[model samples]
Target: MNAAVHIPEYFEDCDLVEGEDLVREPAFWLAHVLLTMGDPGEVERYGVDASAYEAMVDRLADPGQPWPVLRVCFTGGHTAYVVYANFEDENNVDFFVRHPAWGRLGHLGQCGADEAGPGLSWAELISLAASAQDGEEGLSDPSQRLLLLLPMLGDADMPGGARDTVARALAGCGIRPDAAGELAASLLGEQDSTGGPRWTVTGDSPIAVCSSPYSPRRVPLGLGISPEQAQALANALHGSVPPTASGGFTG
Candidate 1:
């Protein structure tokens, strides 16, 4: 089947169901995002070797204590993620505390990357994956502003395949394959194209436009965790946050 057929038209405008408080304990919360939204290439780019990460799937399944849940809040300028767990050290803090979603809460102090550059939310990430634009950078302009990426890479079961599926969908929309890196760029504001952006990843007047340099490195997720498990984690985190004073956000 043509995977492009499933791609959404307005990648940035795609609907996202806001989750309640999934993040309570920052460490555990960070782990959850690392499990789900972390960018492996970013990790590698920062000199963090993938080989050094100890696969935590086994720990997540410990029955005695399942992995902590994380819920991230979304906004036009930033994202906020809450975690529920007993955090211990810098490793946990480094992974989640520095995450883009949680960083919106001033959790990272001046260490936040999005403060100086374009960052993305999971919703935006998914939207880019399903759009006709380049998923990563390097296809055309490396400094394009249409795209934003979060540093967290993979936690979902089908990492590489999943990335490919989204890429194919975007390509179906007419985006070039070389622009794959754009998929990780930040999605900010709605674009009112005069005649709809060209699906072509290259050349001016293309269907989609990427705003930054997208790294080509495809990161890895831990083994054994299923998409269902990830969804469950998202749901659990939702139940933890309290509602707003206006009677909204029934976590």
Candidate 2:
């Protein structure tokens, strides 16, 4: 009946178990966190939009692939994660901030309160964030630092600026309006042994990097192609990488 009565507590310091089961079903995760953690309104958009994201894996996930697992912990602690999402371009790189259990820090709560918040109050989080700038770590540790985002306007309870921050963070993990853009951007194409396509598209983040920023980065656009396919894609893209780019990256 009522969801609040059975709220769960935070996970252990480094407990990484069947988090996949929890993330696979977003509604349960949201309710569990909201009830157990209380709706701090830091990570989520509050209703449908937030629900759409949290439940996305369960709603439309590839069962063939292993469910993306996550871990949770208190301030300055570490959890486990299944993916290290990121995206690289010519110069920069961006990552998805997964707390092993905290899910996406951007989606958990306001900075520092949720996974990235280190369980601190808003005031503490702000101060921590301010302090990070003076040190070697600039918001690298979620416990010690926090993302200062507050909902400022519109249907989105999250501020436009804050929303952008979350948006970029989500992008770091390949969560965006165009989920397939990664495959659509390349002028070249090939397929993996499992018939997976080897193409290129501008992704928000590269695979297997879970940090933050969620900005656009140089995505490693490499594909393994047979001689025939290589020639074709190369021709399409105005020739291969001049032998060096044309060489086999792995073997």
Candidate 3:
């Protein structure tokens, strides 16, 4: 297949090179995101408030350590991504972490990174990763999401008979009713016309979804998502919070 993405110039000659192939490296990645801090408007984009961002980074990492880490991941496409909250109004949104160094930069639009904003040095970050080589690699692999989701297919834990309805719909679509969970699981890899790992089905669009909520500016749920909405998604995905609770047409 075509390269997952055009390997950016940054990784043009890394020892990890594989003749322009997309090989699974770190399953899950956590870095301080030195570019965001002190960059006015960046910190708030990841949490409820600037202090919340500070508190989290401080709570989780040491001084001069990777703080307010953004989880980086790559699945189907060559891009690695991160989903966080919006700074403007506190909405949970996802965006690209492109560097051309990480094989491909996550975002390729107006977002700028001419130089490191204000934080650790590249050497320091590299050293940190080397030290944590033992850290576990995460799994958001596109092909396996279906299996991860199988247990929820007919579970009573799903709200408002939604699971049952979804199963029926899958069967109607000529998909095996038993593969209902696979369908939903498979969707974790997409949304709203844009490719991403985050997904949401609005009350307005029961049969569809939107992905990649942040671009330093939010796209509409019809297009992407906002922090408040992302938080609602978190609640639902974790608590079986019904779509109706988020004011949906589906209910």
Candidate 4:
């Protein structure tokens, strides 16, 4: 008998169920996304280096390499990913970016654990990748406000008071008060058990912040505020009393 005819018989001893669960599996979604991607040549028009892009594609396609452990999709149809390449080493994770436009892929670099601090979280990686493409102003777009707050929202060490402060600040940026709070709460719910490390302000020239030790990325703060104001905001988010003279965080 043909192998096709024995397909059912071959799996008769295996347990099977019919429903949406199989379709909803991570493996299924990964395969679907990979299959739908256009030819990598399309990415060349954007000026991406052919060799590097091809190497990234090869690594992703290699079954011997680790599969992407996490994927975050932005409102603008951009996607960020983290692939854990080594289980024994905490720093052996790679960040990758992709957009629906050309399905172009870019490597954001690898992150690993270090004695200095914590590594970047998937949310921060998404923000960095998005900002690189759309610039800081894109982060402040009213439609993307929630995404802008994700790095802070996903910080497990952020205090409730700080969260409230951030929500109020976001409201000042044009989001409805009630909507802002609800959105923050909803995002928190989604990550209640998976919050990453705390965010710490490490510089002032441009207001840089780090989420963890040995992180390869440092996110610049201040959606549009002065350097001093950004410093105050970072302090407030860390649960410190902002100088009353600083006027508090507006954004």
Candidate number achieving the greatest lDDT relative to the actual structure: 4
Q: Write the per-residue lDDT of candidate 2 for residues 1-251, one digit (tens) a residue.
A: 11111112222322212333333333433333233223424334322256464555232233333222333222323221222111121111011222233332322222111233112212222222232222221223331122111110011111123323323322332333242233111201221224321223334322211122221212221222233433332232221222122111111
Ranking by lDDT: 4, 3, 1, 2
lDDT of 3 by residue, 1-251 (tens): 22122334333322111111111211111111222212323423222355544554443333232112222222211222222222332222223333222332323122123321111111111122222112133223322221212211211122343334333433433334455444433422222232322333466532122233332212221123444444432232233322333221131
Looking at candidate 2, the ten consecutive residues that score lowest on lDDT are 149-158
Better of 2 and 4 by lDDT: 4
In model 4, which runs have C-alpha deviations exceeding 4 angstroms?
1-70, 86-91, 96-156, 159-208, 211-213, 219-251
Residue 144's lDDT within candidate 4 is 33
Write out the backbone clash pairs for model 4. 91-112, 117-212, 117-213, 118-212, 118-213
Name the better of 1 and 4 by lDDT. 4
* TM-scores for the candidates: 0.20, 0.21, 0.21, 0.27
Q: After superposition, how far is residue 62 of candidate 4 from its true place, in Å?
A: 9.3
Put down candidate 1 lDDT per residue, 1-251, tens digits, no spaces.
11111112112322222112221222222233244334434433322333433334234323344223222322221222222222232112122211222212222111122222122322334432223222221111111111112333221222223344333333333334554335422211122344312222233221122232331111111112344433332332223333234322211
Q: Considering summed lDDT, which 10 consecutive residues are worst modelled in model 4? A: 1-10
Residue 77 lDDT in candidate 1 = 19
Output the lDDT of residue 60, model 1. 33
RMSD values, in order shown = 20.8, 20.9, 18.3, 18.5
Off by over 4 Å in 3: 1-57, 60-63, 67-77, 82-104, 108-251
Query: What's the CA error at residue 6 for candidate 2, in Å?
Result: 20
Residue-pair clash count for candidate 2: 28
